[model samples]
Target chain A: MSAAPILAAFRQAFAEAWAGGAGALLPLGFLGGTAVLVPLGIGSDTDTLSAVGPGIIWVSLALSSLVTLERIFQADVEDGTLDLWLQTGAPMAGIAAAKTLAHWLAAGLPLALASPLLALMFQAQASLELLVHLGLYALGGLAFFFWGGVGAALSATVRRGGLLISIIALPLYVPTAIFGALAMTGGIGSDGAPMLLAASTLFACAVAPYAMAAALRLAAD
Target chain B: MFAGQGEQAKPLPVTLLTAPLLTARDLAILRGERVLFRGVGLSLSPGEGIVLRGANGAGKTTLLRMLAGLTRPEAGDVARAAPHHWIGHKEGIKPQESPRGHLALWAQAWGSKANIPEILEKMALKRAADVPGRYLSAGQRRRTAFGRLLLEERPVWLLDEPYTALDASGKAMLDAVISSHLRSNGAIIASMHDIAGFPVTAEVTL
Candidate 1:
């Protein structure tokens, strides 16, 4: 039940995934394509990626998070390593917590940190404005891992459902995208509404772990 | 040269007790819409031994898993003492890991120090200690699995097809190990195709 063993397990899981080319290539490729193509799509005086940059960033973060789910149980399960994990005297809740934390660090944290460059490519206006958008993107990215955990757990037992995860996960991500989009483009209609959007992001983060754990137990069954 | 340390362990003899070490009443196993076994009743007390015999695909693995607490029964009672040692038929040892490391992991799980050299020497696995488990021959891998059983402290042992890759000497070692365990008054339920090694314990066939 302690945090240490679970954390250690998570680190080991994450490291193995990283060494094995853990998710991000597909999403990164898609984003890179959008970065190049979106500017071409908007041929008018209105810039391209700038107009669509935030949206693409949001989608890419979601995709990236989704891709990482493929690695959650693949290697361990294949190698019979998970037998030991499941047999350990520890509770599942702690295991879920550690897994989510590692997923966020490996998958979400880097995506968020790189959001500013994406924002700049879109020809965003001011540094402060770009920072706000990037900040919002970062929060949104962090929030996605919880959903990803749930998705990963849902797919844990299945052999090849990792790619199908977007179908299972995209619905839960709608609210975050909506609130995040509003926060990004200065679309807050009323006073204190932006704060509400930020609050929702935090709320998603809080609720993710429990839901993911439940999904994992169900998947395991 | 292997001496009294047998290849396949004898079901260690444990003190006889009224409380059964392993019990299942009306137990049933269903795997993926297939009923493996139904109304299986079994009980093994200390110093008792039973051989699980049936045709292939007769739910031997499923029943073993159910008994090991790795799988749940669909009906009836399947109860056991906590922390009993179980070795399935699949050579469940991790292939990429070294023999020594696998023993260490087994030790960790069963609460015993691996004493790797002693185990390797006893099992004729000393030469393969540093080799990956996958690289070993079938008999060698089975030997590796037997090495893990050496560290088992529990009174109840559930072994499935443990004779799979053993040689003449290896088979003798197994017989000796089972004898030693029986001598210690431990209870054993082993699913095996051959019954030449264990002579004293009562045999139950399903």
Candidate 2:
């Protein structure tokens, strides 16, 4: 009935994402670590790095977000916060959305901010256009969490749901990953690709919450 | 300090013998292939407490969850006049945060007016107020979970194995809290292997 509870949940979820110190840094570390390993494995050829840079960044972002997916609702389920929320008469969908938003802020935002530096490591020069691309990646990251969160919610009853989450969510991530990579490499001229990516993000934002909420409700049962 | 607002200020005797606050009829639950329990019925009015007794694997926890509306029964109905509070086996404390931090979040979420410090003191967790939850002992964690009952004023409380890890003092504190809750016309349905320490008005064995 009141917005206060939902807002408080959002804040608490965000704080929880950073409470252990390690949670906030984990995605960034995974992204950066993966980016660093790319160049060492591949040859130092500039053209090769540039050609694969966008793909690598997209892949790293998806993987990193997946890495943190287990935290979205598992901790809440374990500690009884989920039960409390269900009892409070707050909409489960709203709580799921708030947690997903917080997850994006804590995990996705940092990855977006650090993407350019990671891209530069792969010899992709920084530019204003790169900022726009990174912003899209960040936006797409929110969608990633929303979609992956459904899997996380469904697997809430399962202890150590990391692998199950990946199995359930990775397939759902294909479209976003494809469109995001296309927009990244196709540059500013590929307006359709970015537009489609944005649309997917918006669609996921609208739909994932209900699906996640239902999954969580089932898990609680 | 205890009589602040809402139902807390009302005397329990006035609401006694009123309409049932919670009712469950012919509740049956099947876990996997096994029917854990069946034909369980209960009616709880204000100032009443029900202690669910059963041996190990007797579905005490399942019955509590079903009553709390967390789980659905295969065949039966549970009707409640108000939203109930539930404290399951899980402490629900975030290991990374302090007790005060966790309590603050819960209080805000539940819109509780209870004083946090007083609750911490009541639970005898004042000394461990700033310690991360993971560091808390089993007894301390159980006490912290019980502290949630004071934070929110709910008419019904569904507690599963509430005295599992409580020490002598903690168990005594729980008794006192439950008594006060009953005094305020609040109802409790607790599932326990033994109901020796509780003042239960009714008993249901599954």
- Show where candidate 1 strays beyond 4 Å: A1-8, A22-46, A74-79, A125-139, A189-221, B1-18, B31-34, B89-152, B164-188, B196-202
Clashing pairs in 2: A79-B92
Q: What is the lDDT of residue A23 in candidate 2?
A: 63
Candidate 2 Cα deviation (angstroms), residue A199: 1.1
- For candidate 1, give the lDDT: 0.67
Writing each residue's lDDT as its tens digit, candidate 1 over B42-104 gives 888776777888888887766776787666679987876534666665555554567776776
lDDT, candidate 2, A1-221, per-residue tens: 75546776788788788875466599899998999899899989999998998899988998899888887688888787787777666787888899889888888889898988888887888788779878988988888899889989989889899899989988888889988998878766566998899999999999999999899888888
Error of 1 at A41 (Å): 4.8
CAPRI class assigned to model 2: acceptable
Candidate 2 global lDDT: 0.83
How far off is residue A158 in model 2, in Å?
A: 2.6
lDDT of 2 by residue, B98-138 (tens): 77877887777766767999999999999999899889998
lDDT of 1 by residue, A1-86 (tens): 23434654675556544545644454455556666666676753446556677887787777767766766655555554554455
| Alpha-carbon DockQ of candidate 2 | 0.44
